[model samples]
Target chain A: MCHRSRKTSRIRPAAGAETSKTIAKERLKLMIEAEKQKLDDDTLNQIRHEIGSVITKYVDIEPENIEVRVTLKDYKKRA
Target chain B: MGKVITFTSGKGGVGKTTTTANVGAGLSLLDKKVVLVDTDIGLRNLDVIMGLENRILYNLVDVLTGKCRLKQALIRDRRYQNLWIIPSSCSKDTTPVLKEEQMKRLLGDLRKEFDYVLIDSPAGIDYGFSLATSDADLVAVVTTPQVAAIHDADCVLQILKKKKKDIRLIVNNFHRQMVKDGDMLDIPDICELLDAELLGVILEDENIIICQNHGEPVMGKHTVSEECYRNIAGRIAGQEIPIPDYIRRKSIFSRIFFKNTAGKLV
Candidate 1:
């Protein structure tokens, strides 16, 4: 019964550039949250668990670097 | 006033005997007098599958050779009161069920005594297959949806059409996921390939294996496979119950969902 809006803007620089990697990490986190909101809660949970496992198994990033947000909306029962 | 239905598979191990036992049990559940006759001679297995092998002292061979009366040869099914079976002889020295007239006579006698007669035919497109199916008022051609199974089934379909047999298709062991992945053939593809109407579609249910292992018919009250076989029997009995959405896959949403989601999970 509610609406959701999410946005992610990432600014990553090429190697040896002045921009910090922390900025890029923050932007990636924002984009993932936006993508997550577009999916239903169940699908989002599945994707998060699946992606988390794959990333943890293969990616070099620290586990604490990932951040997620989920919002619940108004509830109504159908007749 | 019931029909004689024969279950024939051109390829072996596609559950012809199991289907006969289940559908016969299903029909008997409907209070129809049912008889299941095994025509798979030399390599007999229906009696064993039906759990009546030990009770068979006299067999179809005995009646065919005039050694025993047909009544003495029929074994009552242990589960259903209305169901009976005439098992085949496993002895290698017996005569093959080769003559069409002899089969017609046996079926004629069975037709008089039972409301439904289900014959489990021998495997392959040989004399055993033809003789078992020749007297059927309705023939259910079973296939397993592989290239080899479909090819052999097509050969049998051609032979049955050449003989002007009343035939329909029952696509057995249908794995819907595999079919969606294009790894296995679907029911419509089989029916179109054989140019035959579909009588029923049985999903790949593990309960069939368990039931067969336990020597129990799949037509028990709670089993889904039993319901499918009963629906097939109902269709054969000329009842117009539309094929349920699951079996016929008639719902647009189901078809689109299956088509779209197939093979994506892996």
Candidate 2:
């Protein structure tokens, strides 16, 4: 036989809190992704312009590491 | 058997009533007999949004308590021949059609007359929400991209899962420019967090609010909002509509382009 006794329940953090945190995390991730996309697009466009300028200026010289490095740094600084 | 769909959100003012009204109008345009039941008692707006407020003589409470028959309480849409509504009674008391058994019986009776019964559920997981969903064949969880709304919607989704109900998501009031600018929750992030099948994602439109205030259906060839509603209605009616590439594949094409470039470089 079991004896009857009253037991009080403890309150935990509201369920909505956890869900809210997760939604916040996902939103942050989306913002980061969108920003990264914009940056990448801008970087690509910059690179294209830099490569065109480099080829136009050094048409006589063959493609080499030193020229590309100098051009990339100049483009990065411009950006 | 007729399909009963409930539009619910745990948070308020996320356009549940508006979506219900527009979807009802869209379904009606498709030649289906659609009945929208406003379950938000004490705060009914489906009638006003659908432009049938002045025509109401009987209400949901009257029908539930047997003071009037269902036929008497239903307010037919003047704009659509097959669309109708049972407006909620504005009462201070929280008790509006409280019994689950009563809702089951009422819905069972409603199924005989309409092709689709759309219940605009009250906000939160309370007595009203339970009653509305208990009679639903499908639950359309309406949500916006705002942090609070998404979280509340997720809570509602969890409860619906616990109850073993089939649910589809409708992400409404999304601003595309905000998503593009990294200021708002986009479709992909929302779906990832909720992990539910998204039936539709409606973009934010001022016209929706204007249409509601003017008591008109956002249908026909005039508005983008109407197209979104029509697409949702078509999907509900089992039409295999191609989910627009702008919504589903917004980032996918960019990913592919990056992958191709990376592969070539490596």
Candidate 3:
């Protein structure tokens, strides 16, 4: 017979704050989404520069001031 | 013909080599002729982990470059008569010595000779990885529950999917206590996140390290890790053994009612 310890097993976390596992899951989901997009810094920078240049031709915007962010829409619903 | 399977992890230190060794051993224990190939080139660990380091005279580079015959490069395991290993070259230079065509030809030759040819792929999604997965009939991507490891696994999975390879996921170093305490990611969540067929989950067992330190695989023993490996090997061998639920979080009612009984209620 296998003997188990008498320690109490807490399956649910205390009310209010999120558990570390939840946080890790959310972070991993976002990270994997970003990784799947395969958008490197160089590509993002190029996008930023190209966008900034196109905007400067029409409006007064600096290339350094242009920020390109990649976010996955509906990533939470992803299987 | 034998099936060529490559064990790879995009991130380093995720038990790719250990999994290759133990799974190869487990398959051999099932009376299948299995051969493990270390494809890490400059950073080979399968030889050391399988305890055939001292016997490795001709490595994979030698066999591919015509420096030695395939039989001469293969090192038969002392414990498992049907299991053999072809270690990688340990030269200081990290230049890739084996090309993709060469690796494919070598794997083709291996498939004709063995029932299962397991290749331990080096970490990263570089040339070495391409060479390892070039001719693989199946690819097993090993990863831990960490964010970085899972992210890298997803990256590798995307690449393998583009290549249209049959891919599976293996979760390693799973800490049940931490997962129970809501401190670590559970197996099901990981499987969903990676979006790959679950192969197996190896519990975080120190015996794995201890056995690898002794240049032996953690198989055939009655340890939890051994059972996990055997189940994985069974699945690989087309056995329908159900994967044991390592994270069966006990409900409050069951915890209250079966508290006094043996801890098998969960």
Against the reference, the lDDT scores of all candidates come to 0.72, 0.75, 0.79
- Model 2 quality (TM-score): 0.72
Overlapping backbone residue pairs in candidate 1 total 0
Residue pairs whose backbone atoms clash in candidate 1: none
lDDT of predicted model 2: 0.75
Candidates ranked, most accurate by TM-score first: 3, 2, 1
lDDT of 3 at B26: 97
List residue ranges in candidate 1 displaced over 4 A.
Answer: A1-79, B94-98, B247-266
Report the C-alpha lDDT of model 2 over B85-114, residue by residue, as the tens digit: 999876555645467887888899999999
Which residue pairs collide, candidate 2? none
What are the DockQ scores of the candidates, in order? 0.01, 0.01, 0.01
Instruction: For residues B1-266, write the lDDT of model 3, one tens digit per residue.
Output: 99999999999999999999999999999999999999998777898777676687888988998989999999999799799999997665576666788888888899999999999999999998999998988899999999999999999999999999998888899999999899998876787788787778888876675455456787754566877888788888887765566666466643432232211100
Candidate with maximal TM-score: 3
- Stronger candidate by TM-score (1 vs 2): 2
| Model no. 2, DockQ | 0.01
lDDT of 1 by residue, B1-266 (tens): 55788899899988888888887887888888999898887667777667565577787777776788999998998688799999887554545634788788878888888988999999898788878887788888898888888888899899999989888888788887887677887665676688876777777776665444445676653555766788877766556544454544667875664343211100
Model 3's TM-score against the true structure: 0.72
Task: Give the candidate number with the greatest DockQ.
Answer: 3
lDDT of 1 at B211: 46
